[model samples]
Target: MTEGFLSSEEYDEQAHRLYDVGDYDGALEMLKEGLALYPNAVELCVGLGYARLAREEFAWARRAFERAMVLDPAHEDAMVGMGEALLRLGHRIEALRLFHRVEQMGFDDDIELMLTMGRALYRDGLYTQARDVFGRAVAARPDSAEAVASLGYALHRLGDDVGSGRQVRRALRIDPDLHEARIYLGHLLYDRGDWEGSLREFERVPPVEHWDALAVWRILELKRALWHMESGDARLAPWEDRLRALEELDDPIDRLLAEIESEVAEKDGLALDPSQLELFSGRAEGGREHRVRSPDGHVYRGSWSAIVRQMRDAAGFGHEPLSAFMRRMAERWHEQSGVDVPFRDPEVFLRAAVEYRLMFLEDGPD
Candidate 1:
């Protein structure tokens, strides 16, 4: 069929397929073409909004969402898109209000809507809120493996490791193909010192299916420790290649940030603890008065661990254990920048986090 003869719904569907494959540019072009032909098409506007969002163009996303909302005030997807855009734009309260509006408009039982809002909350580090929404999604669709897995993730972030494990296991039972949940379960087991069990989970996921560098790293570490595999072993080649590919896919800005942090650390004689090579860790502390500036320019002052705690509290993560909070931050850094932050050591973690733009070192309070 010719593109010129496609209906608005067909255009929206084509754009959605492109978006799902991470082709935001193509999705944007398709959406723009559709919008030009059918300016009043609410679905096309919502698709445009999501495509813009995937590109990190929050203001444009909001405008697209606003246009969709004006055309159909009760559009659920449009409201969710606007809420996400607002969250990215630092308008948390308004974003939340829009989510609530969706529920108030009688979409509370909508499993997809609930999951969408829950994931937005999860991405913003609002674990408590995400947990609640995911719970609702699970209730609405008891057989939905994705909803159950999402709830599991939220529970994990909230420091409920036992609950998280159970929910994630249940999700896997519902759909064994849920590799993301399986990978998460592996990390959770690794965190609990269950190396054999962790390796079992990691091995179930084929190296080709792994997207996150952390998982590939863990798989390699586990194989080395459990099987006594040498680094040059033929069995390890695919995983090593996968890790390299994942690392290479990191954002250029993040690479620049890592380079800058590396230079600063080298010049200042800061060295990462050799024991801190892995992702998870126990904890550490210091007594010196340390001050750090967050991305928003707010300064947190105290010892190294204390500064992280203060930042955690400010970010509404005080409810979780300090170690868990640090590990969460470190995991996020790895996922974003493909660089590991040493969660066991506060100083090292903070130093590494500068590359992820999570925090920066500042002079001690005078």
Candidate 2:
């Protein structure tokens, strides 16, 4: 009876667009306005729950899911959303119980439900399980670029670098604008020691979307590394300061990152040439050895692989997990070479190591 009548489906569709683009507030406003016109719409309740989850309002999210379930007792999305909200609320046991119950009830056919569960697992640091769930989601909906990217990230988390890279590339091939795939691909190249390639991907990433909350922080780190190693002081200072202000990372060698950033700031027009920036470049193959002199006048001499081994042995990561290994290596890089590793842990750093060796240890070139 107003300017225009929007059906419940129309309202829900409009809300979906807002939610998909990281505009939770806009989505909520649209959903509420539509719900006022169609108070009995169960789908609108479900959409409200999802938008709340994206905003990290777990309590409200749980209540919204509960409302959706009340409206349609056997709604699969409602059940999955409830479980997800519980997981976010730190009720892992209750969430798992609900998940198992839903599976037993055979109501898990919705691909979105599976995607939501997979992301919850990923956030909980259960990467192996996340990979499995994402695999299922991809199998159910092969065209979902986000599912493919999530699976790739899970594989990366499990230290299957080749598999991770392949999955991420597959996602990119499907949807070139999928930011998660590009971010993963970027770090994958970085792992193999392709700084230029890594820089390219990281720079191309758009603003962090709601689906991936950590993208901005990851980009900041990557850019900071690139600017510090390739550009001079003026360029690096802003990125370095921005990263420092976040206080999100707990790297033991933060002082070293700060020091490197400062070094770039102190330099004039230019500071390093390619030969001097060997650490960032992956040209250490072909019987080429380089002597890297640290900022403190300490010198390490070796081929890239030799240096990696020396650093690995020094960090004592032979028996430890990849994340621990990378963290140790990052600390060593800060301590010895005075550079940020661009990864908060070894798993991410290992991706960068794929193209080239990342090390500061000095042994004779292999």
Best by TM-score: 1
lDDT of 2 by residue, 50-113 (tens): 9988776789989888888888988877888888889767788788777667656764556767
Q: Looking at model 1, which ten-residue stretch has the lowest summed lDDT? A: 278-287
Segments in model 1 whose C-alpha atoms lie over 4 Å from true places: 1-3, 254-366
- lDDT of each residue in 1-366, candidate 1, tens digit only: 234578899999999999989899999999998888899999999999999888878899999999999999989999999999998777999999999999898888888889889988877787899999899889888899999999998998898989999999999999998988888888788768899999899879988888655567678888999999998999999999987665455443334445655665577766656654332221222235666787766566654555665556444344344455677787777788788787755666787787566777776333
Query: Considering every candidate listed, which one attains the maximal lDDT?
Result: 1
Enumerate residue pairs that collide in model 1: none
Write down the worst ten-residue block by lDDT for model 2.
313-322
- Reference-based lDDT, each prediction: 0.79, 0.64
Predictions: Cα RMSD each? 11.2, 14.5
Query: Which parts of model 2 are misplaced by more than 4 Å?
Result: 1-7, 33-39, 100-109, 196-366
